[model samples]
Target: MGDTRWLSAEEMRAWNAFLAASALLNRQLEQQLKDDSGLSHPQYEILVRLSAAPDGELRMTELANGLINSKSGLTYQVTQLEKAGLVRRRTCPTDVRGVYAVLTDAGRRRLEEAAPGHVAAVRAHLIDVLTPEQITAVADGLGEVTARLRALGR
Candidate 1:
């Protein structure tokens, strides 16, 4: 068997930079959403996904997958959102054991209110700092990474 290799200096720098940028961007976005709309970033993501879904409803399992969350974790979040009047749960008509998370009107309104500030924060904090060439490079690099990760799940 071959011994494992570790990252080189350049690779380490790139990996660390990516992690820092991702964390900072998430924090900034989360803060903006909390300040402006009283919604956490994860909650905002759930609402966004539900709002985009057909009939603004998705099976709990499906929502969990879309959020990359464990079923139990997603259930807890959905329950919290339900308490906040942002979402509701319904039994699936076709499947007695299935539950659906339905985005409420309040959730839609909250997302609509939060979106502009979130986008502005993203643009100001990251996109505005990048050159067009850098933007293209980042898009290409991240696209490749996403593709590779998706392939691994097959």
Candidate 2:
């Protein structure tokens, strides 16, 4: 076994705070999205991503990667959205084995309706609470951590 290195008191405090804050923030965002649009945060994220893609469509694998979701989970979410008339699935012409999720007109409208409130909720709960410098620092720090985790295939 390797030498056991434990977090110092300050590190522990910071780590705990980060975990708590992340949980709380996600909960708040989820609630807000659900209340405003009957969509979970993950669902909203998928919609947002698809909406930005060319022709409002993306391959299933690409969608899963962008969301960092499992293939089965993405399939489930896409199915649900499909049932709601928010998205449709299409076979990739060039790759018969591939599938694409395309946002429907209804999905675009739903996102348009929900976006304002979502932005408001984000600003109220997060942006408005932090100074610009602190926001930048948080973004930079999280970006670094994300890059490191991605490198490790986490």
Candidate 3:
């Protein structure tokens, strides 16, 4: 190797901050969701996605992609939801190989119950702690990073 470039001190600080914030936020939100509605974070997200879809459903592949989760992981979560009467999986008529995850009425009600606590936790832990400029900076910076990573097909 001819040369190597490592993160600068400032860059290291930024990276560490990001890692810590994301991990802590995820943990807190997960706990809130579990305690408030007996739903895991991923399950709640699945319900939210389906509830917003045209027919309260989406193909399994599409749901996995949108969630940035592994197909197997999504499958397990969907299965759990199905058993709980919160969701159902149906084969697509036009495409036998495709499966759709549909939110049940119970799922929607669970989401409505979970959302308030989740949003409040998010606000208390992150949003309300930031100034308007910091909020904008975070949104723009993270959005750009997410877009770039997605563009790379990762």
Candidate 4:
């Protein structure tokens, strides 16, 4: 306890900026996604991930890990998507305990419909606001932060 050192002014400023920006950005994107396609941010991400996967399918555990989400959370979201006819879950034939999330045709269509507006929202909120140098700096800096945290089992 005695050896604990608090953040300096600059460090505090950086940390605060990161926290606020990330939160606001997530909020903005969530709203944009919801408005554009009646999809939540996490749902949209699941669709995007599955769309890019081979055969538009991935294991439930893989999906959960890829999204940094809990298995149960992913299950709930997958179930929502399933109800919407946007996704389906399949039992892995070789492993009774394994399940897969498969993107449906409707999911791909919805993603295609949603992509342009989502891209524009992203540009309007973040990318277009930054210079190339700032973008690179952000990418490199956050990339390192993500790598370190992930390495720590985040």
Candidate 5:
């Protein structure tokens, strides 16, 4: 093992708090989606991404990248969505070598219905508890982290 530097008490506390808060937030959101929409958090994310895509469709690889998922995992998720009649997979005409996942009208409608409750949950659990300034700080901090991670992929 490489030489390790011990965390200070304050650092340890902050680290643990961050982990706990993230876990709790994720759990709450997942529960909210399950109760309100019969969808899991990841499923909601997939739908949201597809809805935001042009023509409500995205190449499978693009969708996978947006969701930070493996192709096989995305394929499985898409299969489930397809079975639910919310999404469909179509061969990419131009590419001939790729497939696109297209969000159906039903998928759009489901997202529209689920979004309000999801937003309310977010506000209740997170945003409503924070000042606007705190919200900005959190966004900026997280944006920086995301940027750094994406950069590392280059």
Candidate 6:
């Protein structure tokens, strides 16, 4: 291994704060989603992604990639959604080996019902706490990190 470079006190403080905030935010969001919509945060995210896709559908591989989930995990989530009548699997017309997760009418309705409460929770926990400038700074800083990670093929 190469020589380890330690973080400075300031850097460590910021890093820890980021970690704690991330964990707490996710926990809160998950709890809120579960309580309000009987859905987990990951499930909500899956629905959100499908809702935004063209024709409210995405190939299983594409959905898994976008969600950063393992194939099996994505399949399981899709199965759960399917059981709930929120989504259905369709065979890809152009690719016999591929499957698509298509959001059902019920899925769209569920998402619509969940969105308001989710947005309110987000605003209450994060957005309402930050000034406009701070929000922009946070977005820009995270966008930079995301770009760097993607560049590294992470």
Which pairs clash (backbone N, Cα, C closer than 3 Å) in model 5? none
After TM-score superposition, the amount by which residue 1's alpha carbon in candidate 2 deviates from its true location, in angstroms, is 6.8
Q: Write candidate 1's Cα lDDT for 1-102 as tens digits.
A: 268688899999999999999999998888998999888888988999999999999999989888878899898889889999999999988899999999
Q: Estimate each model's TM-score.
A: 0.90, 0.95, 0.97, 0.97, 0.91, 0.94
Candidate that beats the other on TM-score, 1 or 6, i.e. the better one: 6
Sliding window of 10 residues with minimal summed lDDT for model 5? 1-10
The collision pairs in model 4 are: none
Q: How many residue pairs clash in each candidate?
A: 0, 0, 0, 0, 0, 0
Candidate 5's C-alpha runs over 4 A off are 1-3
**Per-residue lDDT of 9 in model 3:** 100
lDDT of 5 by residue, 16-122 (tens): 97799899999999999999998888789999999998999999999989888898999898998899999999998788989999999999999999999999999
Arrange candidates, best lDDT first. Answer: 4, 6, 3, 2, 5, 1
User: CA lDDT of each candidate?
Assistant: 0.91, 0.94, 0.94, 0.96, 0.92, 0.95
Encode model 6's per-residue lDDT on 102-154: one tens digit a residue: 99999999999999999999999999999999999999999999889878975
lDDT of 3 by residue, 41-145 (tens): 999899999999988999999999999999999999999999999999999999989999999999888888888988999899999999999999999999999
In the range 1-154, model 4's lDDT, one tens digit per residue, is 8898999999999999999998999999999999889999999999999999999999999999999999999999999999999999999999999999999999999999998989998999999999999999999999998899899995
lDDT of 2: 0.94
User: What TM-score number comes out for model 4?
Assistant: 0.97
